[model samples]
Target: MSALVEVSELRTWFDARQGGKRCVVKAVDGVSFAIHRGETLGLVGESGCGKSTAGRTLMRFHNPNGGRILFDGNDITSGDIKPYRSRMQMVFQDPYSSLDPRLAIRDIVAEPLNIQQPKLPAAERDAVVVENMRLVGMNSEALSRFPHEFSGGQRQRISIARALTTNADFLILDEPVSALDVSIQAQIINMLMDIQERSGITYLFIAHDLSVVRHISQRVLVMYLGRGMESAGTDELYAHPLHPYTQALLSAVPTPDPKISRKKQRIVLEGDVPSPINPPSGCVFRTRCRYAESRCADSVPEMRDAGGGHFVACHRYE
Candidate 1:
């Protein structure tokens, strides 16, 4: 399948004042990836690692400082977003805050349609909203209610309905299930998978939860301090994580089977995540990486394919 979304050397920086001094936080530094026409690419990282920023940049929520963003083979970084807005959509992390409580469910879902399909008749737009709500397992009765009336999971379903109502082929799912209870999370994930199966939509699924990402992603990309640490096929990454950061992350996941969990040795990372405003040179992970050598402190490691399409950006892997 062709690449529905492609980003190359994408960078997003934030201006902040630290200790009364100004600095630039490289939230998404030189990240590159491709999402196929109908595949889920999981982007995993700790908080402040820029995974969310990358997703926002892809959706044009943030003005990209550098790199090229292409959706369906068109370079969007240089053009008017108004024309391409409907083709891409985002399901934000917090369902509670993402939706406006004042708007009725039908109007909330219909907002995108209003912006993108102004020429469509009111009846047609309402029909699209009703259809999308049904698609997300909500009924006509629920559409008349407000977001506050629904549970967290149902609110998220409403968010999904809003996104899908635009008939978007690409959806940026930014920690879509992180805020829900485990049971609710499972339901949402299952619902998402079902939606994908039925609609053939492509997803950029960003989250810190490895287990959830592993379950739904065809490919996985690990990020640290605003840069990609490792990327590989889902099974390949779980089977043999090459990057130290990736290894540590997978090690921390408790195996479902007690025997395997007991047998597994977890690699505990030390120190807090460094500030993106002044990320470490060489490898941003060197400060916490046990495998770091003198050379690791001298030069930034370039992402290279070790084998079997697995890529790692670490000096040790070189």
Candidate 2:
């Protein structure tokens, strides 16, 4: 399969004033990865580790401070983003805030069509909204209702409908199921998978939950402090996580099987996440990594293929 989206050395930085000192907050620093067509690439990390920033940068919502963004082999970062708008779409985390309260559901879902595919007539637009709503398991009853009238899960379905209005095959799902209740999360996740199966859509699913990522993703990429710690196929990464951070994350995910649950060793990390504005030198995770040595603090680790295409950015991997 070919890459539907390719990001290389992507960086998104912000200027912040901390006690009168101007500093750069490296929200996403030098991140690189590729998303193949029809596969869900899960991006997992702790809070403020640039997962959301990377998603936004890929969607071209936040202009990258540095790096290349190629969408279907075209350089989208440097050129006009208008053409990319129709082919790619984003589903946000909060359904309540993402939708318009003032507009009816039909109007809300059709908003993207108005912006991205205005050539479609009103009848076609209505047809597209209806089909997408149905695809997301939303009935025609929701077409006339307001956002506040629906549950969290239903609102998220509406959000999904809006994203699909532009007929996008590539979606940036940024914490799409996080805000919902655990019971509701499964429905949304399952629906996303079903949609992918039917439409062959490619997704960059960003979430903090390792379990959720493992369920929906074909490959997983772990990030820390805006840097990619490791990336591999889903089962491979979980079974044998190379990076300390990846190991700690996987160890925390609760296993359902009794035997595995009993044998799993929880890796409890110490210390607070470093400030993005003034990150530690060398490996960003050295402060919390139990396997850290003097060499870990001397230089940054370049991502290298450990084996079988598993890439890890840790000195220990050598």
Q: Per-residue lDDT of 98-208 in model 1, one digit per residue for the tens?
A: 999899998899999898878999899989988888888888799889988999999999999999988999999999999999998888888899999998999999999
Q: Which prediction has the highest lDDT against the true structure?
A: 2
**Could you tell me the TM-score of candidate 2?**
0.98
lDDT of 2 by residue, 30-97 (tens): 99999999999999998889999999888788899999999999999776898888899999999999
Q: What local distance difference test score does each model get?
A: 0.91, 0.92
Q: Cα deviation of 289 in candidate 1 (Å)?
A: 0.7
lDDT of model 2 at position 70: 93
Question: lDDT of model 2 at residue 293?
Answer: 96
Model 2 clash count equals: 0
- State the TM-score for model 1: 0.98
